[model samples]
Target chain A: MARSPATSLLPGITIILAGAAIGAGALTYPLGSVFRPGPGFFPLGLAGLLMATGLGVVIEARGSDAAPPEPFAWGALAGVVLSILAFGLTVEHIGYIPATLLLFAICAVFERFRDWKRLALTAAIISALGTAVFLWGLGLPLAAFGGA
Target chain B: MDLLAGFQTGLATALTWHTLMYCFIGVTIGTFVGVLPGIGALAAISLALPLTYYLDPTDALIMLAGIFYGAQYGGSTASILLNLPGTATAAITCLDGYPMAQQGKAPLAIFVTAINSFVGSSIAIILVMGFAPAIAEFALEFGAPEYFSVMLLGLVAASTLTIGSPFKALSMVVFGLLLGMVGTDVNTGQFRYTFGLFELADGFSIVAVAMGLFGVAEIISNIGQPQSVIRDVGRIRMADMLPTRAEWRQIVRPTLRGAGIGSFVGALPGTGPGIASLMAYATEKRISKTPERFGHGALEGISAPEAANNASVQSAFIPMLSLGIPGDAVVAVLMGAMILHGITPGPNLINSEPQMFWGLIMSFWIGNLMLLVLNIPLIGMWVKLLSLPYNLLYPAILVFVCVGVYSADNNVFDIFVVLGFGVLGTLMRRYGFPATPVLLGFILGPLLEEHFRRAMLLSRGDATVFFTNPISAVFMGLSVLFLASVFLPGLRARLLRQKPGAVAED
Candidate 1:
């Protein structure tokens, strides 16, 4: 019946998001009234709504019994993010195919496929087909080899 | 007379090979995407946006429009055959569809749903033909206050009506508004949320935001889950696919009722097919003689909701094209695509660009017919797709998303921005927070702000402008009622002893 930390984290997140909204109001933007509202006016109002909503959620959570939250898939997420970051960093410098191949290999590791050859083959085919479709077919101006 | 004229224009424009070819392409791609898990029409459209840059605006519109409806046509395949809904709206189909398939009625289930989809869409198209012009005529009288007020209602309704925590939904809307406030302030020419990055000057790319949030986020989450189970399909025969006379008799009433409900529900701006299908399914269950047979391969179950889902998809276009109001996120994206094509869909669209309006209408009829033909024969092919491993599918989607987002502006920073949102969206889904509100907010935020400011300027800073105008006053009343209706039960339950019935009301 007790609310676990994982369960309680939702309200905390809502409150944090609201707090961030308020902090982003940036003081310099004029907080004009409803009549002649400034850029900050709507956002200020939104922030207030977020806070009230967050508080309501927090209050509601106090009485309700929340099931324990599922474990976050940090590994799969990290793999995807890192591969994208790697692709972003290298696509222009090292060219599209190599970067995409790197992206594929990195992402495949977290997918937990035991067959390395299949993984490599799948990665290569994806990179080649992707380049052919996006670069050559679509004329995207991406570098296939290393050089510009 | 106008109907005849509209059809003539449609014949001239939509019948062309170029338009026809693009429509074919769009629908094919849409069907492919719809049959696959972990992607919806929104993400597919986002991935296609960059590609559309090279196309004629009309052709682009035709293709994108095809994808929207085609996906709806195809989404039920996975739901029925594998108990997996490729899109949220098809979730209801899984209830009776899988049951029917389990009872050796897979082919018949597919056939009934496909035919029913055709029926639903045909009715919705007729409704669109009848009502769109009248709605546009009414829309012509809408000034800034009325526009802003209605959009406010849409925002509130979209946030509140979705399946999730109401507070989180509200927060997501506000979050979307805040995100919209980023980039240069339209009124003051001031840099608001941009942290001085040059790319931030133009604000975040809608392509990056939408693709990352919907597309990449889906891949990541789907990858985390175990692989989907595929059902054996050896027993089904071609003859079994066609509904018997008895089956046809059973489905006729439910199919007609579902289409009626769908057309009406889909016309309601700020709602989606998910709601319509659920309503249709529930209605069928309630009206059925043996309600207990509802979940266990009842023919009405597959036919009704399937029909409703497709009908809602088609009728959802009415509000978008005529009134420039999107009924859901997919239509909202379609609206964005229209804007991107330098065409603002509203009252003036009918008068100014009659060809485009009529051409699109014609395309819908042709497109629905194509889907009917395409879906029935392709059921086996779509079933084959279910055998595809989740591993390669994830990589293909991820890479496609990467390429699509990166190509939008060719900015590396956009990639990072997508990464940020992708993680946020993944986390959002993991929690109970809905993604639609944020998307709805992001799309509508700028329009709402622009209209709000314009309304304020027209009133010369009169604070009562929102209430003084009867149009805005009505919208305001609706919005307030909407919000109050959502939270009133929760508030009352907290005040009094909460009963099971009270919680079940939702």
Candidate 2:
């Protein structure tokens, strides 16, 4: 159950990066007038808080005597990331049905699905049912075929 | 007389075909999710949110509410029969429930839980029917300062109740607040955290974040663990599922106590069924003359926490429906669903839309009854599902998450966001950081910020507005006291020592 200092340090880095990005975004908009709050005021304040908290976590973790952190689950992590990317890339071109089928199939691989037929069938059925429900039942403007 | 009339109207609305069908669907889906380990009710509601877009708002809400409570009942089954708790709230059930099953009394444990859940929910429903409007009316007097204080109390309570490193929990809450900052600024016309992404203009989709954190991250966690055999307790016969006279007597006092604790805890902002269940279990053990018998298969141990959890689930709606501030993540998503359908929830909602209010209230009763009936027959089926290979089950979950997120906006951007959140969630879990606080923070973050800003504006930059409002002042005082109690070394040590049952269970 012990966590490594690296585990804490990484999130600190993420917070810093997120804070910088948010702070940069805040600069683009007016901070608001003296009488009224501006669009950027909240974001700027929040970014500062995020950076401070992230830094605090890193410092606290470094000083703690807890167990070292375990290795990250990279395989499952990569599968999730790749599936999402594939979905985003294919959704517009192949449409919802095909894109979802591919996404599901890719995700199934991480779940240890070795049989191609089972994975494909499950993905196809899921895609078809999802399309029918969201598009036909709900009347959402989900494209069926790529052009449509 | 008014309470009777409200019930009569609620019954009329709940009896309709549309409402009944939705209730059935919600309870059925809820039971499945509840029985399955790792997939919580929050994910179930978030996944179902898109499907409700086509239904009438009342029916949709009724269905969602059914799922919320139904999950509470269903979660106990796995906890009692197996070592695994289907949800965190059910974790307490496992302390004694699994021992009961090991002693060949799984059905008895299930029976006790069922009755307890029924009693807990029934009491809460009666209170809601009788007192919701009165509470709503009283809440109408609250100004921005009061709302801000309430939100502040909620964040603090959520942080304290969450399991794991407090620092991580606080960080997650802050992260949630930052996430809430995405999309258009309500007071100003400009967007704050969109980062050139038009898709995020409406804010990071609640469905995306919820599903990613609960659903997709769960799948990732499961993948890392070695696949183990899903244990099946023999067919649960009706005879075995009925509680004996001795068992009933053992559970009665605990059930009543659980109901009382659950109702009050559930009414508090941020604390919900999860905290209530833990507290109820610990309290029951403390009051028992023979505390030594607790983890060794005591029916009261199973009954008190299970009953309290379900009761708290029903009562948690009080703050959400009456005050318009969701108490937890599930309720937060429920609030989002309501807003998405153009139904504004608040003090005036009951007055403005009595049918909607009454229909939702009525549907909750029907949903609870439906869940009880649906769960009994399905217990066998769920036990059978435990035998299914994780490989097959995990893929189906991913498909559900993928399709569920895609349907939210018909945009691929959400799909990407879900993946990003999935990674974030997995990392959070690995580091022992609780995800629920993040959810609470995300849902309440904007409301907090808005109210805080407004309070400041009205006070002309003076922070004393928070202290000036009587209601807000009282809550802030309590918040400071609670924080001190939690952080002060002597007080923390004393509180920890007093809750010996919780420590043992942990």
Candidate 3:
């Protein structure tokens, strides 16, 4: 569970970059006078604070005890991201039912549950329930199987 | 208004069929999620947030609040039965709850915790009635500078009080503020960081952010993890639930003390039930004559933390109701719900919206009573629910999250935002950064900036106004004190070697 020193500093480094990026973006807007501060004033101040705290973290992590995080679930991450993406991409074009089925199938593939028959049955049941609840009951603007 | 009038208004609202129906739905969902191991109250609330969009604001709030405190009552079931915590706040309940179950005293442990929870919440509700309006009245005189300073203290206190690196936590708050700044700037009507996306003008939907951080992120992390199966504890009969006379004596003092500690901690701007329960458990062990019996079926162990957690959950509403400042992340979402419903919660909330305020308070009693009934008679149902596999639950959760966010604005762009944040939240969790403060920061960021700018304008750019105003100065001083507490401990540890005789206290 012991973490490498370089890995332990990753969070601080990430925060530093985020702050710098935000601060640079803030400079494009008006800075204005202190009496009448512009839109950029608060963000610029927050950027500086963020970067400073990030630096503090970096300093504190030096020679400090560290433990590695749990193993990243790449497959799970992909499954979830893609499933949601599929729903977003298809719900309007292919409609809610197909989109939902696609989502459930993608999740099943990544989850390593190979029982397609059962997956389809559950997917159909879910699609029917979602269509009933979100479409008919709630009157969301979406068709059942065709494009909305 | 006086307490009696307030209760009457509350009862009038809470007793309505519409409010009661929603309250029942809310507590039912709350207990269901609370009995499950992986899905916490935060995720459950976010998922349910969309459905309440069409309801009355009062009903919506009653339901959301029910989910929160109801989870506290139901969380102990998993801890006592399976040694697994149903919610993060219930983690302390596992200490003696599991041991008691192993000792064939599971029914007694469960019964005592339910009773203690009821007692704890009753006391906190009394305090809420007595304190909220007074605090709100006192806060009515707050000017822009005072508001800015108090909010600064809340952000600082919230970030520093958490159990992690203060630097990391503070950075997360800053990160959240940055996220909040992405929308159209309200002052000049100029877009600050929309990046040319038309939808970004309104900024990220709070529902999207909340669901991604708490719901979708949780689902992603929970996937591929091995889950423990629940073992049969047989039927819990009514006869086995009664505690012996000695056990009853042991429960009374601990429950009262735990309620006291919980109310105090819960009323603070940045703490919540998790800390309250932990403190209650530690205090009970410290004061016990047989301290060694702790974590080994000690009757005092389960009762104190259970009472403390429930009491804290109820009392956490105090800050939100009085100052419009949420005490924790879950409450932040509840606050966001209020904003979405076009209701601003603050000093004027009680004065302006007496029915909404009092109705929400009264609903807590009804909700707690419903939970007692559900947990006792329907206990076996939840135990059976524990055996439901995560594989089936997660995909459904994913679908609900996607549909829920999309339905909020009827826009597909928000779904992508949820995806991006879901990934970001997962990385943040893995990198030792706390996510709760990020949410608190996001919700408070716009309000914070608005107050800051107004305070500056009123003072004619005199930054010292924050320090010169008495009320504002006290809050600023408190913020500094909180910040110093974070850094001083580390500095002291570096400066002096630890002596055997000197014990470090939290």
Candidate 4:
């Protein structure tokens, strides 16, 4: 039996709703703060609204006559995610230049950069320019190679 | 005399060597990014914001404002030369701009667009100088309830933005509001959805969300398209780009009309430059002696929207600088930057920091002049840039996005947040959900929450205070009217039926 796109989205929607509920419920613990309305009040209200809205979406999706959802572009999505991760993990240790270069190369994989030499040249130029402007000229306290 | 004095002071401040250099740099960079497809003034400003950390606040703002208006001028260059709009505001320009180019009138289109942009922005700047203080004083009357109602109206208008299902747009907005709720609670000092993570304490940065949604998602969507070799306008001299006498005659009236429409729409929070351009284009078409002449490369069509867009960019500042309320995401970011510089933006800003306020306003006129000078000579260079491969461009954009986000707060967590939003943005695009509404929700969500809580507190837990406030009541009425027009089945059906061509256009 094949599942409809709406049905497939149910799990994601449910998770979102669960998160909203958890977010709202956690706020109740600190409802008696000193502020006129306190911090918990807004979060709890927003979280409840969010959960209700998510549930509404789920119900609406189930009833609507919209077409099946398009298949997610997992490759491009994964490439973006990985590039972000590489930049995050390496920015401090390897410095801005190396980390940015790694990200550029990873993102290059999304588009078919058939000419490796051209790609490498472009990446190098970008890294050099970025380093000059953001690091050297701006005098950011970023590590050049690795050590602080 | 006051205007002239303000202008003199502004000129004095703007003429400083450092400020002039930064102005040149700002317009140059703004034009470059604006020429590039998918990059815009907002992205340019975001990337440039960190650099301002080292500069004088007045100079930084002067340069930033230059870039903001410069992008509007540069955006028309792409729309005229290529059918592809560099920014959403330029989308209306593409309807007639491409046709004008095809008619061997590319230079005329570019020239007229630049002139109109200059005129429109000049008029708005004059208005800003004349009325900003008065407007700011008017805005001071607004309380939390009024602000909440205004935001409610904004969100409702944002919902009408999507050409597709209203329900989907509302869902996207709700999702954004929820995302905005992450990190430590502002009032309680307790983490709400950090899930044992310390980095989430600051909440997700607007830079992360904006870069991901506009920049990264755009790259993802454009990845698989077959690459095309850039076309060359061989030996097209710069003089050839200037508008002919007849072209000027056709464009002047439309340009004035566009400016009027832009200033009015831009004063409303949430309806900004993009909407102004669309409205100007539609109004121009409606009023034209020959409506059918519009898409066939009419010079008026290009001029009107271009004028409106530039005017809107300038007029949008009225709300931000006056009320300390931003009309859109770009202005919101600007407000954040101002606050970071220890400058409070509100009613007292004009009186307290007359130099900053008047100097900034005066710099806009200078910026427009600077843009005209900077844009004309560089048209050839931008045309050359259009030849670069998209594959090469995406990587550079990715790298820039990473660097820009990373530099903000020097936190790696921002990168992950950007990535998450990028995927979500890509999905939203594919599903025909409007992204601007999400931005509106994120910006206005906290304000709405604060106001709701405040109103509740003031009324001793009763909700009637929100209704009792006269200003709030009016805004709430407008919100209801907007929502009713959108959601009521009979009205929706009638409106949808009337705009059958809208679906085809979308």
Pick by TM-score: which candidate is best? 3
Interface root-mean-square deviation, each candidate = 1.8, 2.5, 1.1, 3.3
The 10-residue segment of model 4 chain B with minimum total lDDT is: B497-506
Q: Per-residue lDDT for A63-125 in model 2, tens only?
A: 777555566668778777787788777777877777777776777676554677777777677
TM-score of each: 0.94, 0.92, 0.97, 0.90
Residue B447 shift from truth in candidate 1, angstroms = 1.4
Residue B326 C-alpha lDDT in model 3:
85
Cα misplacement distance, residue B223 of candidate 1 (Å): 1.0
State which docking tier applies to candidate 1: medium
Candidate 4 lDDT by residue in tens digits, B135-157: 77776788777877776776776
Which pairs of residues clash in candidate 2, taking residues 3 or more apart in a chain or in different chains?
A3-A69, A4-A69, A32-A38
What DockQ class does candidate 3 belong to? medium
Q: Write the per-residue lDDT of candidate 1 for residues B201-281, one digit (tens) a residue.
A: 867887888877787888777777887778676655678888888988999999999999889888876557877788888
Off by over 4 Å in 4: A1-23, A32-36, A55-72, B1-9, B238-244, B489-506
How high is the lDDT of residue B305 in model 4?
Answer: 81
lDDT of model 2, residue B431: 65
C-alpha local distance difference test of each model: 0.80, 0.78, 0.87, 0.74
Model 3's number of clashes is 0
- Candidate 1 chain B has its poorest 10 consecutive residues by lDDT at B497-506
> Fraction of native contacts in model 4?
0.47
> How does residue B304 of candidate 3 score in lDDT?
91
Name the lDDT of candidate 2. 0.78
User: Sort by lDDT, best first: what order?
Assistant: 3, 1, 2, 4
